[model samples]
Target chain A: MPEISYRQAIKDALAEEIERDENVVVIGEEVAQYNGAYKVTEGLLERYGPKRIVDAPISEAGFIGMGIGASMLGVRPVMELMFWSFAYVAWDQIINNASSVRYMSGGLINVPIVIRGPANGGTNVGATHSHTPENLIANMPGLKVVCPATPYDAKGLMKSAIRDNDPVYVMESTLLYGTTGEVPEEEYVIPLGKADIKREGTDVTIVCHGPSVSVAMTAAQILKEEHDIDAEVLDLRSIRPLDEEAIITSVKKTNRAVLVEENRPFCGVDAQIAYTIQNKAFDYLDAPIQRVSTIDAPAIYSPAVEPEQLPKAANVVEKVLSIM
Target chain B: MVGFYREMVRIRRFEERSLRVYQQGKIGGFLHLYIGQESIAVACASLMGDHDHMITAYRNHGHALAVGMSMNECMAELLGKATGCSKGKGGSMHFFAPDKNYWGGHGIVGGQIPLGVGLAYGVKYKDQKGSAMAFMGDGAINQGAVHEAYNLAALWDLPAIFIIENNGYSMGTSQERSSSHPKEGLAARAEGYGMAWEIINGESLFAIRDGVGRAIKRAHEESKPTILEIHTYRYQGHSVADANAKKYRTKEEIDDYRKNHDPLNVYRLFLLDQKIMSEDEMKEIDGEAKQEAEVAAQFADESEFPTVESITEDVYWEADNPDKRTSEGRLFFND
Candidate 1:
């Protein structure tokens, strides 16, 4: 086993995949010379050279579409967006082209392209720079969306996304990039659309993913040590092709559920999870499904104003206690 | 030359028949006709090799036919029949024939430009001699994606040809109104990216074939990308639903172009004057085209829709893979 930061885990996956396959190339804005805007791709350029580690201009639509086009032939391109919010500029390429090509082509062509970038909001990057669009992207049928909350999941899922035949969108958190976790040194891949239970409990199930998983874990700890209430924490690593079985199974065991996420409450990922739990685990539930999510509004600019708009551990704890 | 004229005639007839079906309520969704813009697709597609790739925007019926997609499959797709080229999943705006290396008929205006560049990048990366051609309209020229794609294609020197089918109007807005410098047209924008560019008369099949042939050769031999502005026109309105085209342009202008500048008529006259084919031979080809279009319409009408069970299919490649889990049993209400 090896302890590495989440950022290092992702870098490790890129290096390993590039070594294993000649077709694997990383392309995006500042991914090569600048070593990535968030430094998640640090040291990759020197290891892989200019061909494999391509530095693209600040053109999300163009580079991302090129990645898709290249994938259609034989190359497996891992496209990095400086921020997931910038995907709006390339929405037609991502949503219309990358996501629909496989289905539209009758499976004759598969876009094995991985679009990975930071999609979390709590960094006070303002509305334009900060967006958790996993929910929006998950709405498309031809795409596989994954949001990894830990270093272990980051490495495993990145490897899987690169190898997968379909277009996969890896949503990372700017805040969790430096967090360390124990990951196996051996080659491994955490299957997409699977959930990982971070903490075990029986009283209530707090389901979360991405950066909000840590928030739910903190709430679980407080619930146990302070309130003497056992709260189980479930981390949904992949959003689309969602692990509904794991979600329903956990809710059925705990009999009470709280959905936590950093996205907007309206039509967010948590909203879909809550609906699934209520419909599947309705008979097992003892209380209504509660959710802890960002307030329905644009991301605020100031650090002080941002916290109030975002969901915290206290919100998860309050939701869990209210159900209990 | 007769073969080229026949191909153009085939595309024109197919499009006219498609319009008839669309008006008859048989073909559903949007239908973009290539009645007046057949020479560009016919000529450019004729220049493509077996390994080359082609992609274009929604005005794609002509490209599909020009790239050798069977009339029956194209018509079936427009009719939303499962026997279609895209298996009925993609209608008029999203036709695909990957077997022929035709990537797609993208609906988004400028969306296919970068994807085309990427296809060329793959060819270069694989050390293949093949190249890719991406077609857009005057409307898509202003899209930021097109500019980004141009810069990357030029910077990387990928083997790609970007053809701007300047059809006078983008949907309803005239190029003069949409473009910043209408007189210079989109060809001027290519100089900024340092890419070789030319504007050819899209009505003349020989001019189009020669210009695009040269660009494709440069792409294959020199690994260079070129921006080709082909000035063409669309006889019909933007889409099938744009019945009131007169609101934007005058009927007299439309009639003048239809009579004087139709690509099919221009090429037909060229071939006949050059003694490429006799009047009887030309009429025979025209009749065969009309008959083929009718047969395609019949095939589409006889085809069935995709079954309900397959609604979830093709969403992902691995339907039975153990790792792939969908939101199936988790929310099932009915036992």
Candidate 2:
């Protein structure tokens, strides 16, 4: 196993897919020459040339719509939205054409497209820049939303998303881009909607993803040593095809649940997980489902409030202890 | 010009039969007939090779029939039967026949503009030698997406021909009332995007053929986008709802346009003067076109509607499993 960062895993997946299929192209702002806003496409431009690596104008609506048009002609495009905040300008293309084209076409077309970008709060980018829009995308029926918490899942799931015949929304967190983990250097893939059980325990089930998955794992280890409460941590890789069975199985085993997310509290991913738990396994629960999420407010710029707005290991521990 | 006269006759008789079917409640949904813009489709279609692609606005029955879409399929689609081009799913507004290189008969006014550029991009990306034409109405020129498409096509030097059928109205509103400047619509707008522009009278088939030919050649040779504005008018109301459309425009104005600028009459006069077609031959051609449209309508009337049991089918790409209940759970969330 080779250790790689989350950013490298995404780059490797894109590179491999492009090399495998000549029809696969990448288009975004600064994707061709500047490598990408986050350097995730650093060496792709030189390898693929200008035909495969397209640096579009600053208009998100124009390029994203162009990607859809290209996809209609049998070219699979992996579009980068620069940042999650910038996607608002092209919401018409994403929601109107990208999400609804399949159902509206009555199965005559398959949209093999991916819109990848970094989401969630960190690095003091202010309110407009920092947002975790997982729930907003998950609400759409035609889109498949995936957010990998580690390097292995990022590489494997991204490869699967690129090959899938549906539009996949790969929501990455800015905080998790540089984080490193063991990634296998072979022909392997982790299919979409398969949840990974990070640690096995019997007392409490902790569900998380993206950057918060790391916090949940750390909290699970601390609870095991100090509090004497064994916590089960499951990293949910995809939100749209959410692995509800694995979640119900864990909840059925532990009899207690704590849902953690970095997004705001109202209508967050935690609410969906908590709702599913209560609806599916209400009788199996020992206590009411508990949620640990960022506060419901515009993210403050100060360091003091930023930590509070982010789901931390200590907060996960507190939520898990409270539920146990 | 002779070809334009025959195509206009065909379009006129086709739509006349269609209007009758619609009156009898045989056809459903919004149906925009291309009666007045006959010369424009013929003139522009003359420039397209078999390898090139074409996409157009909702006023598309004539274009689809002209560009090799079987008259039976187009009529069946209008009748909302299962044998239509989109398998009876897309009505008069949406018809996609990829085999004939007719990308779509899109409903959105300016939606096909960017897709035309994408087709041109694909042609170039695949190292093919052909130009793509995107036809839009005068009303669609006001959309923002069209401007974005123009800029991108110019920025990339894409070989795309953007033709605006300046029929002087959008639904019920006239161009003078809707737009700021009445003179220069899409042709002048192309100048801002650094593309060449041409303005031609759509009533005159000779002028339309010359203008479209030059535009296509320029797009192919220079590898640059071109905007061609064809000044035309619609004889019918916007759709079936416009049967009594006297509130929008005066009857006297419609009479004057029909007398002076009717594309079929213009071409018939040219053909008669050139001794290419006699009065009897023209009458014979009109009768043949009427018979063809009548036969197509019969075929559409005999077709059947799709069964209701296939409602949940084709929602996704072949991921059906008996154990999964929800659509998403079957494909992405399988245990």
Candidate 3:
């Protein structure tokens, strides 16, 4: 076992996959020469050469669709979107080509492409650049969505996404790149639709994913020390193949639930979780399910208000207390 | 020569039969007939070798037939039957036979362009001597995705052939009303991307062989990209639903194309004048083509619709193979 940064873990998974699969190639804007916008894909161009580490222009629709097309012919392309927000320009390709093509074509085709990049809004990057589209992308059925919060989960999930036989979208956070976590020095993978209980308790359940997972963990610690409320924190690593069983089981035991997410509240990923908890574990509930989410508006650009806009440990604790 | 004639006739006859079936309310959704633009697909498909790939827009029944897609599956697909190429999942606008290098029958106007470049990219990546012929209508040229594809193709020197089937009208808008008519024609826009460009009279199968043939060679031998603006015509409306086909233009113009630029009549006349086939033999071939279309129509007419149990089929690879499903969740959301 060893410690590694989340950014380095992603690089390791990519390198390992590239070494194993000849058909795997990295295609994106500045992924090669520029070493990625966040320096996540540094040294890959030199290691794998131009054929494997391809640099695409700032045309998300063009290169994304190109990766999908190549994937059909067995060229496993891991497409990098500089920011997942840019994916809106190529909505037709992602929705129609990448996601629905296989189903539409009656399984005559398969788009084994992985679209991965930063997808959080903590920085002061304004309204457009800051978008948490995990819910939006996961809303589509033919696609899979994964958001890795820790270095260990990041390595495990990135490898799984590349090898998965469907179109998998990996949403990472620029804020979590430098964060360190323990990762084993052996071949391992984290399966999709599985949740990890970061901390164990029985008073209340704090279910979250990606960036919100850390906030949940912090809120759990605070609830124990200040309010003396022992909260169980559940991290959903994969979004689409959502771990409903894990979420329900935790809620049943705790008898109370507080969902924390970085995205908006209107039809957010948490909305699905709330519905699931009420639908499945209605009798087990001790209180109505509560949610802590980013302020219901465009992401603020101010350094002061932006932090206020996103869900905080204080917000999660407040939600937990209200439910208690 | 006779083989080409048979394929062209088969496609034309198939389209006519499909159009009839469409009117009869047997086939659902949009049916884009490829009545006049037959020789272009016949010639283009004739040139495809071991590694060559082909993709086209929604009006793709012609290319599907030209690439050897059996009329049974294609017609069944149009009729929304289980035995269709896409198993009734994709109707007229999404026919596919990937094993034959026929990528698909895409619905979106310039959407297939980038995918075509990817096909060429895959070919070049594998060191295969192949090219991808991505076909689009005249209206698709204005789409932003097509230009992005053009830039990528030229920038990478991908073995891509962008075949713009300039059929004069995109849905209801005519070429004059919709596009900029440069001196060099619509495909002159390729010049902006520094890609090689050409124009061919799509009425003649011979002209397609010479023009599309050259572009394919450029892609295969030099791993370069080319844009061929093939001047073709469509006798049918955008879809069978486009009732304003005659209102957008005059009856005389449509009649003029039907009489003069009809690839079938022109190529048949050329074959007869060159002594490629006798008049009696040509008549017999037409009879056979019509019979084939009739059989396909009969099969599609009688075939069963997909089963209710198979409604969620083909959405994911894991759905079909539960044993190998890596993720643990409900792939299908049904009651």
The model with the greatest DockQ is: 3
Q: What tens-digit string does per-residue lDDT give for candidate 3 at A157-242?
A: 99999999999999999999999999999999999889999999999999999999999999999999999999999999889888
Writing each residue's lDDT as its tens digit, candidate 1 over A1-324 gives 879999999999999999999999999889998999989989999888999999998888888999999999979999999899999999988998887888786667788899999998888889998899998998887888899999999999999889888888999988999899999999998878788899999999999999899999999999999999998899999887678888888889999999999988888988788878878789999999998899888899999889888899999889888988
Candidate 2, residues B76-107, lDDT tens digits: the string is 88898877776676788877666666777777
Error of 1 at A139 (Å): 1.6
Give the per-residue lDDT of model 1 (tens digit) for B1-335.
Answer: 77888899999899999989998998787898888999998998888886689999999999999989999999999998889988888899888888888988998888899999999999999988888999999899988899999999999999999999998898889987888853566877878989989899988888998999888889989999999999888878899889777789988988988888888888888877889899999999999999999999999999998887666666677663436642222211122
Decreasing TM-score order of the candidates? 3, 1, 2
DockQ of 1: 0.58
**Model 2: CA > 4 A from native:** A102-106, A262-283, A292-303, A310-323, B1-6, B23-29, B181-184, B241-245, B318-335
Candidate 1 runs further than 4 Å off: B320-335
lDDT of 3 at B135: 97
Off by over 4 Å in 3: none
Docking verdict class for candidate 3: medium
Give the chain B TM-score achieved by candidate 2.
Answer: 0.92
Query: Judged by lDDT against the true structure, how good is candidate 2?
Result: 0.81
Ranking by DockQ: 3, 1, 2
